[model samples]
Target: MPPERDQSTNPTGRQKSCARCVKSKRRCDLTQPSCLRCTRQHFTCSYPSRPAFNAIPVAEDNSPMPDSSIDNVASPFDMSLIQGHRNTSVQSRQDTCLLDLDVNAGLESIGILHDLRNTSPMPENQQTIIRSIRVPQAGECRWELTPSSYARISYAIDRMKQAPATMVLENQTPWSHPLLYEDCMPRVLQEAHATCALYLARNETNSAFFARHVIDRVKELTSSPPPTAPLDILARAHALILYQAINAFSGDLQLNAHVCPTFPHLEESIYALYASLQSSETPPSPTLISLYPATTARQAWRAFILRESSQRTLLILCQFMILLHLLQGRSYCFDHACVTSKITTSAHLWNAGSTIEFASAWNEKRHFLVADLDFSEVLEGAGPEDIDVFGRMILVTILGRDDMLGWFAERGGVF
Candidate 1:
C-alpha cells in the first residue's frame, strides 16, 4: 500500500499543484511564480482557483460521518481524488489543458493571428475572423529559370543597384506615383528612399557609417509601433520593401542577417493592409472614375490610387520574396497561385498625371485585369505598350525574359 502524503508543509492545510503539473501527472514542488516541473519544461505555470468549500452543497446531516464510512472515502490529497476533481471541474467549465498552454507563444508562431488582432476594427456587420493570408506555393506552376532568363535577371539586379541614383534625381519608378509631389509623400517613405540613396552612394570612406545607419534605420522602422491608418500602413510596407530589396540583394552577409528578422514585420504589415482593404469600402472602379465630375473624379482617383497601390505593393513583395528565395537556393515561399488580386496592366492608366488624364487613359487604353498570375489573356489581348514597367517586371519574373521577348516580337515591339 502507498504511504499517506503529509500536508503539514502546506500551512493553509491545502495542497494543490499547478494546472500544467496536474494535467501532465507530474509531481509539483508547489513553488511560487512557477513550479520546478513547469519551469524545467518551459510550460506556463497557472494554478486553478481553489473551489469555495462554503459554496459547495453540504450534506443535510451536520454530524460527522462514522469511521467505517470515512475509511471508504479517499483523502483530499490522494492522486485519484485530485484526478477525479480535475476531470469534473474541466467538464463543468468546458475547458481543457490546451487552453492552459502558452497562448502567446502559439500566437507568435502563427503571424496572421497577431496581425488580425492589430488590424483596424471592422464594422460590426463586417467583423469576421481572418485565419491566414495564403502564401504562394511552388507546385502550382513551373517557376524554373532558363540560363538566358537568369542572365536577364542578373541585369535587372544591376539596374536595381543603380535605382537609388534615379531616385536621387527625383525620377519616378514603377512603384512611385508620377503625380505625387515631394511634400505630399509620407515622411517614412522619404526616409527610406534617402537611406537607400545614401547606402548605394557609400564609398570606401563612408561605407561603414552608411552600413550602420542603414541597419539602425531598418531596425527602428520595423520595431516602431505599427501604423493604424491604411495609407500609413501602406507607406510603412513600401519603406520596408525598399530596405529589404537593398539588404537581400546587396551581397552583404552582415546586412542580410540584420534584415532577415524584419521580414515578419513586413509580412504582418502586408496582412494588416490587406485586411484594411477588405474591410473598408471598395474603391471606385476605373470605368466609374471616368463618369464622376472632375472634383469627384479626383477624389475617386485618389481612392483608386490607394487601393491599387496596396495591391501592387503586395504583388511586388510576393514577387521579391520568391526571387530572394530562388537566389538563396531555397524553396519558393509563394507560388503563382497565391497572386489572386487583380492588377492594372495599362501603363497610361497607372501613370496618369491628373484626374482628367486618368479618365482619358481609362477610356482610350485597352487595359487588362490580370489575376492569379495568369497572363494568357494579357498576352493575347494587350500589346507591349499596354503593359506597364511593374506589369512587365512581374511577367518577366514569372514567364522569363525569353517568353516576354517572344511576346514583344509578336507585337512588333522591341524588348
Candidate 2:
C-alpha cells in the first residue's frame, strides 16, 4: 500500500459554517458543516439550508453530534425563545402563532388544507373545515325573476329586522308583563302600519319600512283587487291597517277606535288596539319614528301587536310564534311583511334592549311549547291540494300533525 493515506488527512472537506450560519444566511462552506463559528455560537450545524417549501426545515437540532462537546442545540423555529418585538404573552402566543402560520404558509398550504378538508376520512366535526364553493349557473334559482317575487322577497327581508315587544318594555316602570306589553302595543302597531304605508308609497322621506318595490305590489293590488280571493282582502286589510297604525304612531290619531276597526273579524281587536294607543299619556311622536327605526320583522310585528292588541298577552304569543318561525327559517317572509308593514317608522313603539329581552324570553318559551304541542292533533281535515307546499310545511311543523308533517317532509314544498 503506497503510504496508506493518513486517515486524518481525509479529503471530503469539513462543514465550513455551522447549521445556524447556513440557515440565517443562505451560505455554505467546505469545513465540517457545523463549523467553528456555529460551534462557538452554539447552533446545530445543518446542510442544504434552503429546503423546498413543504420539505420540513432540517431537523438537525435533534441529531446527536459526533463531538458531545457543544451544548444541546434548539430549533430556531421555537417561538417561545423568539426575540421578536411583538409583546406576546403566553395567552396570546398560541392564537398569534396560528394566525401567523396561516398567513406565512402561503396559498399552497391553503389548497392542501382545502383538499384535505374535502377528502377527510374523519367525521363531520373534524371535517367542518370543508367549504362549499358556490358556482352559480344561470336560470338555476327556485323563484321566478318576476317583479312581484322581487317585491315579496325584498318586503320579506325588510320585515325580518323588526324589534320585539318585551324589548320595547324593559325600561318601563313596575315591569308587569301584561301592563308593559299592553301600554306599548298600540304605539308599536301604529308604528308598524306607518312603516308599511311609507314603504308602500315609495317615500324615502317617510322611512324605508317596506321595500320600495313593495309599492309596486301595492299599486297592483289596489289597482286590481283580487275579487275571487278572501286572502287578497286580508292582504289589503293588513296593508291598510298597517298604514293606519303607522299614522297613529306618528301622532296622526285620526284613526280612533271608531275608525273602520281594520277587517271585519278584527274590529274589536283593532278598537282595543286603538284604545290602548290613545291611552298613552305621552303618546308616541313622529320624532320618535325618526329616532328608532323599525327595520325588522320581529320589531315590526311586536310594535304593531303591542300597540294594536288590547290583549297584550296575545301580542307576546304572536311575538313568540313569529320568532320561532324566523329561527326555523319557515314563514319568515310572511311574518316579516306583517311586522314591517306595521312598525318601520315607529320609534315610540319599541326600544332596542327591551325588544331583545322579550325576544329572549319568548325564545325560551317557544322551544318548550313546540315540544309540548301534540303533533298528532294538527289540521286533520285539510285536503292535500288545499295547502301550498310552503303553507303545508309550516302548518304541519307548527301544528304537530305527524301525518301532515311526514307527508310534507317527504314531499317537500313543491308543485
Candidate 3:
C-alpha cells in the first residue's frame, strides 16, 4: 500500500511561496506580513492561515527507533503516527517506513523543511528525513476566529475611561454622597446606572442611543407602583437627579449637535418625581420614611442615609419645579411646599467606611437639625454657592421669578 501522508507538512505546497511564485513554480523567500519576492515583483504576497500542520504535537508516547533503522524510513508521512490518519489500519513499523521518494522530490528540491531531505547519498538520522506530502484528513482544526480576550479588556478600559466624567459630584466633602449617590443605595440601582453610563459613553456613535439609555433607566424608576426598598428609593431619586444634570450639560455643550434632535422630555420627567409623602399620588409611591415605619433611635439613625439621599433628590426637584413654573409656565409633580420640611445636611458625608460608622456618626452629629433645608432662606438670602443642586435650582427659581416680576413691572408693576 502507498505510505500514508504526513498531515503535518504544508498541504498547499505553495504556502510559503508568493502567489506568483506558486503559479510560476519559482522559489519564494517567505517573509512576514508580506514576502520579498512578491514585494519586489509588485505582487501581493500572503501566507495561508495554517502554513503547515507542524503545529500538532506528535504522540509523545511513541518511542524513537535506532539510527540504523532511521535512513530506511525516508518520510515522516509513512508513520501512521501522523495525527490526521487515525482511522488508517496499523501496520508493522518496517512497512510504514515506505515513503514515496518520487512524491517528496519537489518539496525536497524546494528545500521546504530542509532537514527532511537527503543532504548526502547516505543519510545519518531519521531527523534527517524530509517531510513532503500533506494528507487531506477527515477533520482539520485551526485557530479559533472568535473575538479575542484583548478585545473585551479594551472595551472595559474604554467604559472606565468614560466613568469619572459621567459620575461627577457637585460636592467633594466626605459627608456628600459620591456622584450624589448615597453609598447605601441598592446594588441593582448602581449597576443600572453603570450600564447606562457605559452605553451613554458611546454617544459618539449614536447620540439618540445614548439618550435612550438614560431615558429608559428613568422610565424603569417611574413604573406604576415604584420600588419599595429605602435604598432602592434613594437610588431611584439619585438616578433622576443625574439624568437631569446630564441632560442640562449635554444641552449646553451641544454634545449631540445636529446629529440628533434634543431628547424629548429627556429631563422633564425627572422634575415630575417626588418622595411618596410629597407625591399625593392615589396611593403615593414608596419613600424611606414609610419603608421602615420604625420609631427607634437606631432605626432612625439607620434610615438617615436613605432620608438624606431622598431629601436631597426631592428637594432639588422642588426647586426645579418652582423654576420651571416661573420660567416656562410648566408644572410637574410635587409642589414647592411639598418638600419644604425635609431635613438635609451641610456636607454630603460619604466618608464613613460602613453602615455602622454612618449610623454612629449620624447619632453623634445629627447634622440635619442644624443643616435642615429652608427654601425661603435659600430664595431670599442665599447666594450661588450657598446650597447644592437644590441651591442652584433655587437660584434659577429666583432669577425666573424676578424675570416675571420685571415683565409685570414693565406693564406698570402690577401683580
Candidate 4:
C-alpha cells in the first residue's frame, strides 16, 4: 500500500510519537530530529530507544538529501543536537520560573542561584560582601497610630505642605540654609527650588509645561550616576525629596503617578549619603560644639547641619510614604524600627544663621538628641522654645495634638 511506505528508516510498520507528546496525550506529527508539536511549543522532544535490529543505518542505495532539502526531509538521528535542544528548553523554563517568582515577590530576588555555574568555592561570598558594608543603625521608636493620632498627623501634613515652598522662598527649614542661594549650593538644588516655586504658582495654561519639566528633571536626577562626594549625594537626595513631596501633595494624578516609581531610588540615595556621613572623620555629635578655632568650629557646624538635614529629610520621606500609601488605599509595610537615627530637637541650634550663633545656641540652650521618630526625650528635657518646626511635627505625630498641647501648657508656653 502506497508502495510499502519507507520501511528502511522506521523498520516497524507504525510510526511512534515523541515521548513528550505521549506523556501529554497530544497528537505528534513525528518529525525526526524533533517532532512538530514539540518544535512549535519550544519543548524538548525525545523518542524511546529502538531495538538493535531497528537501529540499522539507512541503505547506501537511497541517496542522501541535499543541504537545501535537509530542513524539509527527516534527517537521521543525531544525539548531540537532541541533547543541546533539551538543555536549551530546560534553561528557558528555569528563566521563566525565575521571572514569575520575582514578579510575585514585589521586590528583587536574592541568593536563589548563588552559584549556578559552580565557578566559586564560596558560593555565598557575594552575600557576605553585601553584609560587610555597614549602614547607620536605625532607631527603635516604633509606634501605632490610633484614628485620632492619624488625624493629627494628617493635619500636621497639611500644615507641612506649605513648608517646602516656604523653605525654598525664605530658607526656613534646617536643610534650607540662608546661604543656599550662594555659590556653595549645588546647581541641582537651586533648580529644584525653582521648580518647586513654579509648581506652587502653576496656572491652567502652564500646568502641562510644569508637569513635563518636573517629570523630566526628576528622571534626570534619579537616572544619573550617583555622585562620589557625600555633599553632592545629599544635595541630589534633597532635591528629589522636594520633588517627591510636591508631586505627592500636588493633587495631580499624572504627576503623582510619575513620581511613585522613583521612591526606592530616593531612599537608596538618602541611605547612601547617611552611610558616607557616618564613615567620615568628622561625624556630627554634641562634642562637635567643643571643637576649637573659628575655622574648625565652622567646619564642625557645617558637618552638623549636613547630618541633621539628612536625618530630618529621611524622617519626612518615611512619613510621606506612609501618608501616600494611606491615601491610595494601600497598606504600607513600613519597618518602623529602621528610623532610629537621632535628630537635633533644639530650634536655636537648627536655626542658627552662623557658626558663632550655632555655638552660642549650643552653649546657651538645652538641646535634646531624640530618636528621629521618638518624642519622649524632647517632652522630658526640652521646652517648647527648644523644639523646631521639624521636631514639633514629629512630636505632634507621635503624641497627638492634645498631648502635645498639654506638653506646651506644662512648659508655660503656647502650643
Assess each prediction's global lDDT (C-alpha) against the native.
0.55, 0.28, 0.36, 0.55
* Residue pairs in candidate 3 whose N, alpha carbon or C atoms collide under 3 angstroms: 116-129, 116-130, 174-349, 174-350, 175-348, 175-349, 175-350, 176-348, 176-349
Better of 1 and 2 by lDDT: 1
Question: How does residue 128 of candidate 2 score in lDDT?
Answer: 27
Please provide, for model 4 over 333-358, each residue's C-alpha lDDT reduced to its tens digit, 9 standing for 90 to 100.
33222244557778898787888888
Error of 4 at 356 (Å): 2.1
Query: Which 10 consecutive positions of candidate 2 have the poorest summed lDDT?
Result: 98-107
Better of 1 and 3 by lDDT: 1
Which residue ranges in model 1 land beyond 4 Å of their true spot? Answer: 1-163, 180-183, 286-293, 334-338
What's model 3's overall lDDT?
A: 0.36
List the candidate 4 regions with Cα displacement exceeding 4 Å. Answer: 1-149, 172-176, 179-183, 282-293, 334-337
Per-residue CA lDDT of candidate 1, range 338-406, in tens? 234567778887878788988777777777776545667877788878887777776665455677889
lDDT, model 1:
0.55
Over all chains combined, what TM-score does candidate 1 have? 0.61
In the predicted model 4, the residue pairs found to clash are 138-340, 139-340
Total backbone collisions, model 4: 2
